[model samples]
Target: MSLFQLQFIHRHRIVRLDDVPPQRTLLEVLREDLQACDAKEGCNEGDCGACTVVIGEPRDDGIHYKAINGCIRMAHSVHGMAIWTAQDLTQADGTPHPVQAALRDHHATQCGFCTPGFAMSLFALYQNKVCPQQAITPETAQHYLSGNLCRCTGYRPLVDAACSLNDSPVVTPDDVTLRTQLSKIEPRGLSNDNPYLQPHTLAQLLHLRRIYPQAQLIAGGTDVGLWVTKQHKQWLRIIDVTQVRELQNIDTQTTHVRIGAAVTLEQAWATLACERPELKRFWHRFAGLPVRNSGTLGGNIANGSPIGDSMPLLIALHADVVLAREEAGQVVERTMPLEHLYTGYRQNCLLQGEVLAYIDVPRPSANEWLRVYKISKRQEDDISAVCLAIQLKRDAQGVVLDASIGVGGVAATPVRAHQTQACLQGFAWDEARVKVAQQQLQQEFTPVSDMRASASYRSQVLVNLLQRAWYESQDMRCITLETLA
Candidate 1:
C-alpha cells in the first residue's frame, strides 16, 4: 500500500506516477514528466482555468465526466479515473478535436496559456452532449466554461469556441492500452515507503487505518489538496478510497437514498435533480462543474466547515451519516445525524481509525416543498456568507404543518432554527405568520462577524430569506405595508 504516487486509470490507461512526489500538482507532472505541457499553471490555487482538464470517474451506472483544475489537484488524486487533457483529444495524425477546430476558426487563443484549459473544459461539455450535436448557444457555453478564467484574451472568442457545439472526431482511447503501460511501474507512497494506498475492500482499509491512524482518507481532493497547495502542508500517509467499489454505490430504497461516502457532489446533485427539479438551482450554484465533479458529498460533510454549502440541505432533509471504524478486525458502523456529526468550527465527531461510509437522505412526502438558497458576495464560485435551507410540509388546509430551517454561516456549525420552525408549525401562510417566524429566527442565532459579511448583515439577510421563502411558498403575490419605527 503506497501513500503518495498514484497509478491512475485514465481512459483505461494506467498512468503510474511512481516517481512523482505527493503535493505535486497534476499540472507539474504533465509539464515536467509527460512533457504534455498544454495545461498551464495560472493561479495555482485553482482559481484560473489555464489548468482545466476533464476527468472521467467510474460510476455504478457508467462513467461520469466533468472538467477540473489541474494546477491545484494532487497527482495522487486521479487514481481510479480517466483524465483527458487537451493533448489527449488530438488525433495521431495531429488533427485537432472539434473544440480545438472551433477555437482556431473562432480565434479563441490569445496568450495560449489559457487556451488549452479552455479547450479541455469545452471538450468535456462536448463529450457530455449527444454526438453530431447542434451548435452550442452562448448561454449554454457560458454555463459549461463558467469555472475557467481568461485574463489575457477578452472572453468573447473563447465563449464562441464553447458555443460551436460541434462534436469532435469520435475518438475513444483504449483503456487496456493505457493500463498495460501503467502496470510496469512500481507504486510509490507520499512518505518513505508509503506510496498510494488503493483499497479494494473494507477489510484492507480498516487494516491500513489502524496501521496509519494519522493517515488522510482522501475520497476527493478538492478540499484536502488545498490544505497542501494553499496552506503548504504535507500529509504523510494518505488512504485513497476512490478505488473501493462498495463506497461508490448509490442505493435508493423506498425509505431513503443512501449515497456512498465516495459519491461525488455532481453525482448527488444529478440524482437529486432527477427526483426534484427545484434543487437544480442549488446544484448548479453548489460549485463550478469542475469542483462538483471532483468533490464528494461525504468529504463536504466530513470537512465540517461552518459555512460549507452542502451541510444545510443535508441538515434540512434530516440526512444521516454512517461512520465505519475498525474493531476486532471487523468494520463497525454507527449512524449519526449530519448536523450532530459536526462539533465546532472545522471539528467533527469522527473517531480515530474511522471514515464516513455513506449519507442517508430520507424520502420527502409528496406535499413536501424543499428549497435551498446560498447568499454570497458573488453568485458562483464563492463561499456562502449566509446559506439557508427550508423544508416545508403543508397540511390539508394549506397551512404549514411541519417545517425545518437549517442554516449555515449563522452559527458555530450548520444548525437548525427550531424556535423559528415552531413559530410557523400551526400558522397559516401569511404576512403575519412570516413576521412572527422572522422575529423568532433573530433570537435563535447570533452570527459571527467575518470579512465576507458582518453579523448584522447576515442577520438581516436571514430575515429576508425567511420572508422570501414564505412569499414563494404562499403564492407569486407579495404585498408590503409601511410601519413606523
Candidate 2:
C-alpha cells in the first residue's frame, strides 16, 4: 500500500484517505480535515489531555480500548485500528452515554474545555472496567483522569462522576459487528516509496532500518511528537516500531520478565510490578493513565531521557537490553546493561540498522531492599527533578554487603552512582555511615540548573532521600507524600 494512503474505522464506519502526509497527526486530520473538533488542540504535547481520544485495538480475545493523546498520535499509526472520538458517544436514538449523563448530572465540567477529554478517558475506562463488572474506585477514577486538567472544577465532581458508573447502569452497544470487521484486517506493509515505513516483523523492521538509515524510529511518539509540535521540526522519513509483531510481546519466565520494544508502559509496568509489589506506587507515578497507555516502556528506555523514571528503576533492577539486526535472513542479537545503552544526553549507542528489541529485567532477590523516590513539584502528573532508586543487601550483623544506586535528572544520561554504592558497601547500615555517604552522593554528579530545579537543590535532595532511606531502614517511621495519599 502507498504510505500516504490511510484507512481506518471511525464512528462505526470505514474511512479512507489518500495523499495523507506521512507525519500527519490524528488530531490534525480530525480538526483540520474532518472538522471533528471534539479532540481539541491544547498543549499539542502529550501533557495536557485536551486532545484525548479512545482507540480500539482489536485483539484475538477482544477489542482493547486505550485512551491516548490524539494531538501527538501519528495518523499512520492508527491505520488498522478503530478510533472513538468524544462526539461518537451518543446513542443512535440520541440518548446520552452513561458517562456523559453522569458527568452532566454531577456538574463535573466547568468552562467545557477539558470536559471532552475527560469524557473520552472515562469512556475507555468504562468500556474496560464497567463491561467486565470490575469495581471502580475513586483511586481508579483519579488514575484514569490524571492526564486531564480542569482549571475551574475542583475535580471532586469528576471523580464522583467516574465513581458513579456502577450505580446507574446502562447497556453498551454490541461490538460484535465492529469486532468481526476489524479482526479481518490482515497486516500490510507500506511501500518503499512510503516515507512512513511500518513493518510487521522484527526481520522486516531491521531490513527497513538498513534501507532507511536516516529514518527516525518511533514507537509511542511520546518524545518525537514534541519535536514536531513544539520544535516545529519535520522528518522526511519515520520508521514506526509499534507494528513489529515480536516487539509487542511480554514473556514472563521463572526469574525475570522480557518486555518487547512496543509494549505500552501501562501493560509493561503492570507486568513488571506484579513481581515487585513495591513498584505499584512508583510505576503509577510514571504518568497519567492515558500517557501510560500510549507510551511504551522500551521507547522510554530507547529515548534515553535523562529525566526518564524507568531507567533508574531498571538500572537498580539490573536490567539488560537486547539489541538486534537482520543479517543473512537471521537475527543478530547483542545484550548489554541498560545503563550502558546511553553514551550522553539524548544519545544512545544504537548503531544504524541495530534496534533495541527487548529488555530483560532480573527480579529482585529476597536479600535486597529496594527504595524508589521521585521528587517533583507536584505529587502527580509531573516531571521529576530527581528520581532515585536504591537497592541494598546487608549481612545479618547489619553490615552492608552490597549496594546498587541509580539516579536521574542530575546527569547527562540516566546513570548509576558507582561511588555512592561503593561508599555504602562494607559499612554498618546505620545513621552515621549513611550520613558519611550522603556527602559522596551529592558530589557524584554536576547537575545543571534548569526550570525544574537548581543544581544545589538536586544535590541536597539526594542526601536527604538517602537519609530518609536510612531512617526507614532502622524501623523508624518516616512519613512520605504517598503515605498520606
> What's model 2's overall lDDT?
0.88
Q: Can you tell me which runs of candidate 1 are displaced by over 4 Å?
A: 1-5, 8-16, 56-64, 80-82, 130-140, 152-156, 167-192, 477-485
Q: Pick by TM-score: which candidate is best?
A: 2
User: Candidate 1 residues 129-203, lDDT tens each?
Assistant: 634355667767877786777777468987776766554455544444544454554443334366457676777
Query: What lDDT does candidate 1 reach at residue 58?
Result: 49
- For each candidate in the order shown, give its overall lDDT on alpha carbons: 0.77, 0.88
* TM accuracy, model 2: 0.97
Clashing pairs in 2: none
